[model samples]
Target: MKGRSILLDHVGEREAAALMVDGKLEDLLIDDDSQPRPGAIFRAICDRPLKGQGGMMLRLPEGETAFLRQSKGLRPGQPMLVQVTGYTEAGKAVPVTDRVLFKSRYAIVTPGKPGVNVSRSIDDEEDRARISAIGHAVMEGIEHGLILRSSCAGADDDDIAEDIAAMADLASAVLNDLEGTEPEALTEGDGPHVLAWREWVSAAEVVTDEGCFEDHGVMDQIEALKSPFIDLGEGHMYVEATRALVAVDVNTGGDTSPAAALKANLAASRMLPRALRLRGLGGQLAVDFAPISKAHRKQVEQSLRASFRNDAIETSLVGWTTMGLFELQRKRERLPLAAILRGL
Candidate 1:
């Protein structure tokens, strides 16, 4: 509530910085220097690898390299291990491998725990193989993973062995500074806003809720809300949060055909515009559909305004309402993906 900004006054004791959404204030007020950051993380020089471009053309330390696109738990000649994960409105520094360290500590396991402990200060054998990789991410509940060195968050076991012998002596001086040629590190991380504040400063997630599938025409009571915890795929939908102000009715979740209501309204309008950029749903929002067949309402509002054409937000659709509602207006910026994974 009460946030959204974009001002830019004349020097000195600020004149504005207001731009709030969901609790409304917006219209963009930018007065500059709210502290700019988007760089830092060293080493990068090893280009040459674009033959058929599956990947490999690095040469960064200052300029090029940035190709790295191998999704679904990335991989390519192993030993990669990235972690930055954010910072690229143009200022680079956006790594993110080791499958985001096993999905950012995936709801930190606690089920009758027998394992899942991390302590360090350097002892050896790669700090006992990073504490046997956090005891195999607490008995393989690691649908994700990452363990480089963090001075052991809240140390104990002899202050995590003096921080795992100082990261096994900086991994033995990064293996004696890569012993003469061929290196491509950039591990300086923590930007995508301080790595979205250590992934939303923890402490939350108590309750939740469902989905299903069965080829073409479904409904065994909707294929019994398919599970692995909800994934109503036709295209995709995973909006874990936005808190409020996101109103998307788009019926056809009962479906028929304007084409299977523009394919379940184009798989939930591209999964509600990427669940409104990962559920950060800002102020005035609306997306009510499921009537469009008056000979296909302007071809489904021109295919939902060409699927909000690569939205940067600042949307508008005002076209149907004699009870066919299709009004639209999305304009929230910053902190979304469900309030930076709800650490807002």
Candidate 2:
């Protein structure tokens, strides 16, 4: 329990995966089989463009529609390939993008962007050069770009080459079906089990048994996420989701010392990302930190920056509001766990 461990299990009948680090739940992925999943590739037909939004609606197979925000030079009925980018709210169009990427464990093939690049985290010059050479060789004549992931740093050379080649081949195969007239799905996105294997590349013990969730305490952790209150030892925070945005209110509890406000604010900031990730909460987030002096604002901001830096979801710190609240805009990548587990 000291190191990382991946729990491959289910919440009700849906496939689920959990990342446990040192006995704490670090991340969670659960399947929502009702709609087109994020990262799924589809050949769609352009429907119509929004007047002032500069975006277009796409018609997919089975009467589903997606919204593409960067639709320029696109005409109605034009056929094109698109990839689902994120989850959709009820009755809302599935958000998609024309920039389709074929991602695997070690490589990501970027169509229309031709370059061989290594992850910036791999700081060793020799390792970067080696990875670059492998990518360039595997993608010599291919038009698609290749990005070597950070996991390739100490991985076997043969495995890295194989992964790159396989993703490139898959991308080519999918891109070639653009001539099809009828809208259809090219590839379904990876399920929770496969996604955990692909994204959680760090060394960890794998648990695939049926009762792994209950055995490893993942079920208990998930139950805690169902509530909005989070205990931070010295203080607590309430994370409430509204239709417009998520509201986080931090309290110093009984601590009334001069540093109590700063302490509670820092604790909330450190735990905020993990809480949101577990609950699959996104969109706008407004945090009402306990009252602290203007001089301590920088410290709180830095804490937030450091906490969100490691989060996989895309989040932008939009700075402080006039009312002294912190705001953030996060991409809605996954369905809310409560919604997924509803009625179960």
Candidate 3:
């Protein structure tokens, strides 16, 4: 409860993983069996170009269609490898990209982008040099790009090299199967347990027992997320998801001090990333902070930026609107938690 803990368990029949920091739920991952998950590699056939949208539709296995935004050189009936980028909204084609990547815990192999680099987070020159040498050694003849993740810092040399080699091998095998005429699935995306192991690389206690979610209060936290309200001690925030966007409203609870508005706004900013992460909410987000003076807008913006800086999801702080609201655009990388657990 005091430190970080990784809980691997199940939510109903679905596999789930939870990351808890200081006894608070920091992140959540739950398997959704309804769609083609992000990171799935496929050999797709170009169907037709949406000239109006400047995109092409790809035919995947099981009669599913994917939408690729970059369709400049692609023609109908051409075969290409694509990766599912994110969840598809209802009645929309799955979003995909031709740039496929093979990712693991310690390394990521980027196909068509040839280079060997280490994570910048490894600030130590010696560590970076050592990791770089390992990567270059393993990928000497490989044309695919190699990126040594931050987890390689201070890691065993043998382990890092093995990881790099494994990912490189996977990329090579997948890239070589581009001659197929029909659409096919090359690999599935990482599941909840595997994702937790890959992304939550910092030192932490690992709990893999059955029903660990219940044992660690993760289920309760998830249940609370079903509601729109979130308590921030002195104030509260409401996070509700609409078909168009996520709406957040901040309010100072019975606090009439001069700085109460700013205080509540800052609190909302700090807790917003984690809240959205747990809920698996993305796309457009509009935050209506408690009415603060223009002088405090910059401070609130800084707070929001800092909070989302380290989040794994890509989020763009689109800045304040003409009205008194802040906006964000986030990648829809995962299915909504509420939708995933609706009847379970």
After TM-score superposition, what is the CA distance of residue 341 in candidate 3 from its true location, in Å?
0.5
Strongest candidate by lDDT: 2
Candidate 2 residue-wise lDDT, 1-344, digit = tens: 77899999998888999999999999999998878989999999999999899999999999999999967899999999999998878899999999999999999999989899999999999999999999999899999998899999999999999999999999999999999777999999999999999999999999999989999899998898899999997699999988889999999999999999999999999999999999999999999999999999999999999999999999999999999999999999988888887946
Off by over 4 Å in 1: 1-43, 47-50, 54-271, 279-303, 306-310, 313-344
Native-to-model Cα distance after best TM-score fit, residue 105 in candidate 1, in Å: 32
* Candidate 3 deviant stretches above 4 angstroms: none
What is the alpha-carbon RMSD of candidate 3 to the true structure? 1.0
TM-scores for all candidates: the values are 0.26, 0.98, 0.98
**Residues forming the 10-long window of minimal summed lDDT in candidate 3:** 335-344
Instruction: List the candidate numbers ranked by TM-score, top first.
Output: 3, 2, 1
Residue 234, candidate 2: C-alpha displacement in angstroms: 2.5
lDDT of 1 at 14: 23
The global C-alpha lDDT for each of the candidates, from Candidate 1 onward, is 0.39, 0.93, 0.92
Model 2 earns a TM-score of 0.98
After the best TM-score superposition of candidate 3, give how far the Cα of residue 130 lies from its true spot, in angstroms. Answer: 0.6
Candidate 2 Cα lDDT to native: 0.93
State residue 244's C-alpha deviation in candidate 1, in Å: 28
Query: Model 3: which residue pairs collide?
Result: none
**Which residue pairs overlap in candidate 2's backbone?**
none
Tens-digit lDDT track for model 1 on 22-114?
A: 323222121222222222222333344445645543334334334444433333332332333332333443332222222121122222223
